[model samples]
Target: MKVYLDNVGERRLIGRADVPSEAGPVWIVRLFGSALIIKEHYTIGTVTHVPDGGARPLMERAVLLARGQPPELLPGWQALAP
Candidate 1:
C-alpha cells in the first residue's frame, strides 16, 4: 500500500516498506519532529520523537507504521513542510 504525507501544500513520499505480517492497514503521520502511527479508523493520536540522523529509517518506519506495524522509534528526524 502507498501512504501519503500531507505537507499542507503538497503530499510527499516519505518511504516505502513492506507491511507487517499482522497489521491489515494503517496510516503513519510525521510532523515537526514527532511520529504518529495510527490505524485506519482509530482516533487516538500519539506523538513521539524520532532519533538523530535517522531520516531513512524514520521514513521506512513511517511506511511500516502505515501498514499497521509498531513504528521503529528514531529520536530526531525533522519533517519540513512543502
Candidate 2:
C-alpha cells in the first residue's frame, strides 16, 4: 500500500497533515512474494496510526478479522459493517 497516495487517485507523497481519501485501483500485496492485483480495488480509506509494525501487519490483522479469526482489534478501532 502506498502511504503517500493523494486523494485524487494519484500516487504522490503528501504531508502528514493532509488526509488521504482514496487508496488505489491496484494494490501490491506481499505475503510470501510480492504480487500486484489490478481487478480488486479500494476506493476509500481510514487512517490508522499504528507505530509498532506500520501498515503491513495492521493489514494482516484486517485479513484475520475478515476471516473470523483471533487477534482482536486494537484500541480506538471499531468494526463497522456495511
TM-score of 2: 0.18
Per-candidate local distance difference test: 0.35, 0.28
**Candidate 2 displacement at residue 29 in angstroms:** 2.0
Q: Give the TM-score comparing model 1 with the true structure, all chains together.
A: 0.23
Tens digits of per-residue lDDT for model 1 on 1-82? 2233444434444433334424434433443443445223311222234578875333232332233322233223333335
Every model: Cα RMSD to truth: 13.8, 14.9
Candidate 2 per-residue lDDT, tens place, 1-82, comes to 2233433334332222211324333222223333453222222343433467555433210111212221122222233333
Q: How accurate is candidate 1 locally (lDDT)?
A: 0.35
Stretches > 4 Å off in candidate 1? 20-82
Residue pair clashes in candidate 2: none
Question: Per-residue error at 33 for model 2, in Å?
Answer: 3.5
